[model samples]
Target chain A: MEAGGRLTEDALIARYFAPLAGAGADALRDDAATLTPSPGHDLVLTADAIVAGVHYFPEDPPASIARKALGVNLSDLAAKGALPRGFLLTLALPPDWTEAWLEGLADGLREASEAFGCPLLGGDTVRAAGPALLGITALGEVPAGRMVRRPTAQAGDRICVTGTIGDAALGLALRLTPEAPWAVALTEAERAHLLDRYLHPRPRLALAPALRRFASAAMDVSDGLVGDLAKMLRGAGRGAGVSLAAIPLSPAAASAVAAAPGLLDTAFTGGDDYEILCTVPPGQLDAFRGEALEAGIAVAVIGSVEAEAGAPVFSTEDGAPRAFASGSFSHF
Target chain B: MEAGGRLTEDALIARYFAPLAGAGADALRDDAATLTPSPGHDLVLTADAIVAGVHYFPEDPPASIARKALGVNLSDLAAKGALPRGFLLTLALPPDWTEAWLEGLADGLREASEAFGCPLLGGDTVRAAGPALLGITALGEVPAGRMVRRPTAQAGDRICVTGTIGDAALGLALRLTPEAPWAVALTEAERAHLLDRYLHPRPRLALAPALRRFASAAMDVSDGLVGDLAKMLRGAGRGAGVSLAAIPLSPAAASAVAAAPGLLDTAFTGGDDYEILCTVPPGQLDAFRGEALEAGIAVAVIGSVEAEAGAPVFSTEDGAPRAFASGSFSHF
Candidate 1:
């Protein structure tokens, strides 16, 4: 609005962002948003930030990038069995930001916020150097003293995961190394599936109620399943013996790994999976599975907690030891 | 630690940040932090993001940057009459980051979290492209329906501000142009005063209780005195005629402006002045001033709401209308 080719800060917020605000945001005119929690509910808070060309490609669709910023944080809440309440966004735009790109981002946020039941509260935007970054802080609600935690698994709990693992990692590999045998051997449908997995995260929020009622310990499987599970178990002062052969995989992922077997490591070690990895007590496993099924989410039983206080064990169906337990270490 | 030169993400968090965790953070080992608000309170939330080489010098002390990331957001909470509850951090480190730098940042956060009574609840860290970014989402609490808002000022209200206005702006001017006449004319104490104001923010949290009781409308003067004041006035559907002579200035700022009269514009229109600008009804002005004195914070009355609705007026001591009213515009 100032005619210097850059939108004034107030005008930018009013034009592009103010419409996305939800209840208690005061239409983003106030310095802060006021949220009155329902009686007997506790707030669950989580924050995640993504950088252009680091977490997502600079050329990726603007809308998907916006969604991912909120989606990843929502996934953390889902893992904790908290229903999405609202989210705050902090974005730094490079000098060359386009109005169309901003519109697309707002469109994406509008759709995702509506779909996830999380509305936009309030946020701040600033001008920065290159490689723009977007951060989100999502708040959720759970009944008092009822949030499932990461380090509460017992020795007899069953290890379960929602949805398949390794698809996003395999998809990332396909995007980065098209000439590789695994990438080249895929059919159009398989390629589409893998790339879609890499681009979009379907956070299993539908199963939050079931997870809250049934799970002993849980976490989002963003960093490889082996490493995340091992970390969770280690925190609980216990360990688990998981069968690598039993790890769930999508049809497209199965086909790609079948074409080039070494990608099995990539599938088990790469990040951005965003699936829910949870533990259920042996007595609650059946009910958890039944509830997950009724919620239209898949749950797989792959292992059991060991009664020992040592590092976790990953093995093949033949009971041979595998060594990728800390393979995700490279990511950190 | 892992075998690689890079600290594993988990180890980095555990070593440097876990000790700062407050209640319900689960020692930073959980998916999310659970916050149970006190009964009959509304949570006020605000988010602010700062980028290296943009917000502060790339060589600025790491701890200060960490503090500013949280400090600016806390200033917003103070303006809304919210008391500190807790905060979430989202940080991205450039590939060349060092452990020493990370430790300094953690140390700063620890001190600030303790000093403000705002604890580190939980956070996420990731490796990213160059030019690191830090974001803080701070949550505070206020008695229900009692938050001070920016657009609630009524006609005939007396506009007031806490602390001096132009020190941070003049300090920034000296930092960016030490050879300027104003910078060169300043004494060592004056220069130090300016630099400190620019480098750190003293959020006026002590005045929040009085503000909740007295202010009709409130907001943080972050952009600049004139522009920010005009913006606040316009938001409330009112206008004000403010006297430039009535604006409070530190002795250092007074000396700098005397040396180079033109820098007066910079003093009035520069960014990062984190003082509170509030409006009080005529009847409550004396009580508000008395309470502010009891709290040991300075309060200055600079202007009065105008009867007619139009762009606010800024005037010099000679009663001639001066026009730097929208001068902070270039910042956006």
Candidate 2:
């Protein structure tokens, strides 16, 4: 290939990635980016990497991979109550990579970049011996010292969750086994809903402003609700009383749980949900919910933070503590 | 493994990486980091990844691997004339990763972080099927809108480089074939010098301020000088006239070239120098040199930019041009 041919790194970047660069990216010609934070804001930074087979199947559509990668990082920014700024990408493609696949991924990145309002700043692209891995370092801006953080929830804080839980877990189950016994009971549309949830995570960025205004603490749910919420409280001398029945479930997840009630545990404990799990003080719960409703996001009060030191889940009917095999999935 | 087992992701970060976190990292208690850029400064961001077996030998010391990973990114920021603030890391280790290796890597990171003034802010750790890959997104601070950029070199500008040029190239040569004739002819200290240069890169952070103050255009020499210098001029209607004899070479590299005359080309064409390649207006060259001397960094002027559009090197004696098969090494 000539120096400027599409096969070379410079050509590849200029052809597929530069168009996504914005503002201070210098069209990615400078190999670095400069971000001048607005006077009143601080930068919230988060990085998340997804590997083929581990995070998603190698067969997953390129666009879906892009969505999941950007979605997961954007979700963290949203939970921190920050507005999107831009992102740096690290793409390590396997030796067997083909141009067609790369084009699909680039197109996927363009769509996700535009949708999340996170432009591509710059990135490192190289060929690795392993399966493909896409890592993103996303930058967001929050008013100085106003970023919602963990272990700040008070004893009376009402724990609320945005959107529904367990959809991702159910989606993964369906992907792993299209003929899962419970899946067989679902209609085609239900199956598609579950799969889409697993494939494309819709970040709840619309609620970011309200989160910083009203949330005492907040975290994005990635490693399941039970474990992630526990993480938010683990480092501090605090506990939470959660009603599993109050954890909103999507219509598809509800259908799956109805067909096989045991799947309820999977819904609550399985990972890859990107919704925001936050705590609102008793005084702010009404306004928080009102804002979430205005943002057109589903807000449900799942439980409350307590002075106790361990997480306890109840069915909310007879109020009996339930046992689970594990709190969340472990990559190790 | 238990939830807090050392093998688990959370435990791994807490045990080995969390201590490196500083300032807004919240001690890694939060999964993400917040960087509050000081007013009047812009955040200069850059990311680079090094994969084992591709960027380094799988058998290379874990500490050496860590140094290279941090050094390369820090070098970019240095070239940008930005002061290091903090960095985010993405570590994907192979399935066979050991605790001892991880411990060594962490210690290396601690040392580099302290030395570079760039603390670890946050990171993501995952397991991959292939060799380990270390990715870092480093942030630096520079005066707003003052970042020195590429393709800005003007005709009559002097081309300068810091430190010795080809030690890394020779070092890599020894590492691959310690029994080569050239290796057998070198002194023990000479061999060690070359190997050390290859194993650990010393980022010239000291020259950063001087670069931004005086350089019209600049870039780090990660790839060979021949190619990278060409890159600096390729986008613009500019070229350079370099005197090959003026290119600085360490005693070790000079010895290697004497033993194998052809190695001169490799010296100029090899990668991983991590030194700054910059252009200064002729009128400011003396002042730039003085500042570099104050910083205790060796700076050499080897070439001059011209209105012509291609990079051509001459042997000052005869003023004859030399031909090379390729300019820089292609990662692909």
Candidate 3:
């Protein structure tokens, strides 16, 4: 980590960055990343920061950190119905890490960049006095008039979510308490699957075009189901009532919930789900799910938008409704 | 600084972010920052990170930190011959800072965003177990074929630089050694002027169009003259020899160098100049300067590019040449 040695800043950049010939832009050594605006398309840009100990475990693998950094920003673009085009990375490194750490991190980013069809355009690297921090800015492109927004939901729109929910939350809980009976009883493959989902959640970019075509309002579920839904409701000047029984859960998550009744609280409040949450009109729900399936994304009808402006209500199958102590994870 | 309280994460984002809207992007509050690219213009994007203690003083004002975060990225755009359009900010906050610090930082960003005519498009905030870190991704627009790059400089190009150099370095020296006789003798106005130059650097966006017309290769001097020039030379596959006496120094810097012979070394090696270092053809030098003066930017002919490929050399008044150090500052 010593900056003044055989490998100077310029030398390191030449060694690592110069060889990266990006597909969508000129190589990484340019002053700025250049992009030709496609005809009749608008661009989308979003940046997110992931700090050690706050966003992920301090001992998390470098690859996981890299994936999470790009994944979170891609999730934002997915919510906006923008196809992944490119990204810029800003890395703040601590003094203790070896060069291997950086190389591994960069390898992971390169994998994600190529997989998502987003080239690494430009970025900066700096040394810091504390835990490592990573910041990623993802750029995307969408048809000019088809971008979905959070404030356009209607009163009668049906709420839908993509993919299974609460898997990552359950995975995190297991990681936090590894010695617990449930954690110990899980098969190795199951543990790996859950951990991978938590570490490297794939952004649902394939569903973006269809969502733009059918959904009225859309967003990514970063801060859990009920909390982010409430945000969309507030933004659209409406409210929602979600059915608890209708909440989709993976088989592992269902079994965990059965074992621990309080697991629903964790399911409702845990962050980093990274699934798309949107509202489609009742008449278009079938079409929306049909298109989503064609795009290889699973879909579930979660609830319906309400006419009244108030807190989001979660109703049980037995007609009882109760509020949870916490709605989502908050970083202040 | 606490995670959950009156000024919670949601409340803070609502208070500061809801009112901060970008000019052309309507979905700033949605999942991503939507940008409608102007017709016939390509997009230019760049990202830079500033780490506390490494990039600035630990006690630096929040306003200065915020400005530097955006200013350095804008400096890159200035080098690319792109118009200032919009930017994204990602901040990693230390746990001990007060809410007032966040407010002051946002206020400073807002001030610069308005002044530069670049709106704050989108960003993320997160907690960190380290010093405050700021990452900025700046986006700009340029005509399809006009985005200047560093590989276009030829062997016979006349190396040029904009504005006075060494002031920011001298300012840093003054700040660090306030008790020195030379620093103590400075007038209040001079001291304030020097420090202001260090804190709030104005990116030369106005000169970009003119640079695109005249310069062959362009880049900002973030890493001292010798270091950054070497980078541009590497990009252009050329070599350069700079005349030490020809380097433009402010009057205060000249006095400081005269007072302390080692101040020359500080002036030459100190980073954070934020001025454009470019290469223009010998025949175009006069026209370049004329256009620069008309655009209200000072220009200086400091060196010339050589046909041979080797390390950059700095020649004194008497024509004695020596190899310059590679990097100015060390992150670790």
Computed on alpha carbons, the lDDT of every model, listed in order, comes to 0.86, 0.89, 0.81
- Per-residue CA lDDT of model 2 for A1-332, tens digit only, reads 55443488888888889999989998999968999878889999999899998899999988789888899999999999999999999999897877788888988999999998999998899789998999899999999999899778888889999999999889999887778789999999999988888899888999999999999999999998888888888865688888878889988999999999988888888888899999999999999999999999889998988888776555556788777777877544
Residue ranges of candidate 3 with Cα displaced over 4 Å: A1-6, A17-21, B1-6, B25-27, B322-327, B330-332
Model 3 TM-score, 2 decimals: 0.96
The alpha-carbon interface RMSD of model 3 comes to 1.6
Task: Indicate the residue-level lDDT of B114 in model 1.
Answer: 87
Tens digit per residue, CA lDDT, model 1, A1-332: 77767678788889888988989997888879988778999999998888888788888898999888888889999999999999999888877889899889888888889899999899888777767788889999999988889999899899999889999898888889988877888899999988888888888898889999999999998888877887898888998888888899999999988998878888888888899999998999999999999999999998999888776788888899888734572443
Which candidate number has the best lDDT? 2
Clashing pairs in 1: none
TM-score of each: 0.98, 0.98, 0.96
**lDDT of candidate 3 over A1-332, digit per residue (tens):** 23345455555665665554365356677778787758888888788888887788878888789989989889888988998888888888777866777777777777887788877788887878888888888888888867788878898999999998888877888889877777677777767766777888789999998888899999998888878888899988898888898888887777777777787888777878899999999999889899999999999987889888877888999878968788666643
lDDT of 3 at B328: 60
Q: How accurate locally is residue A215 in candidate 3, as Cα lDDT from 0 to 100?
A: 93
Model 3 superposed RMSD (Cα): 2.0
Residue A45 in candidate 1 has what lDDT? 92
Better of 1 and 3 by TM-score: 1
Candidate 2 lDDT (Cα, 0 to 1): 0.89
Cα lDDT tens digits, model 1, B154-267, are 889999988898888887778789998668888999999989888888888898899999999999988888888877877887899888888899999899889888878888
Residue A9 in model 3: lDDT: 57
For all predictions, the C-alpha RMSD in Å is 1.5, 1.5, 2.0
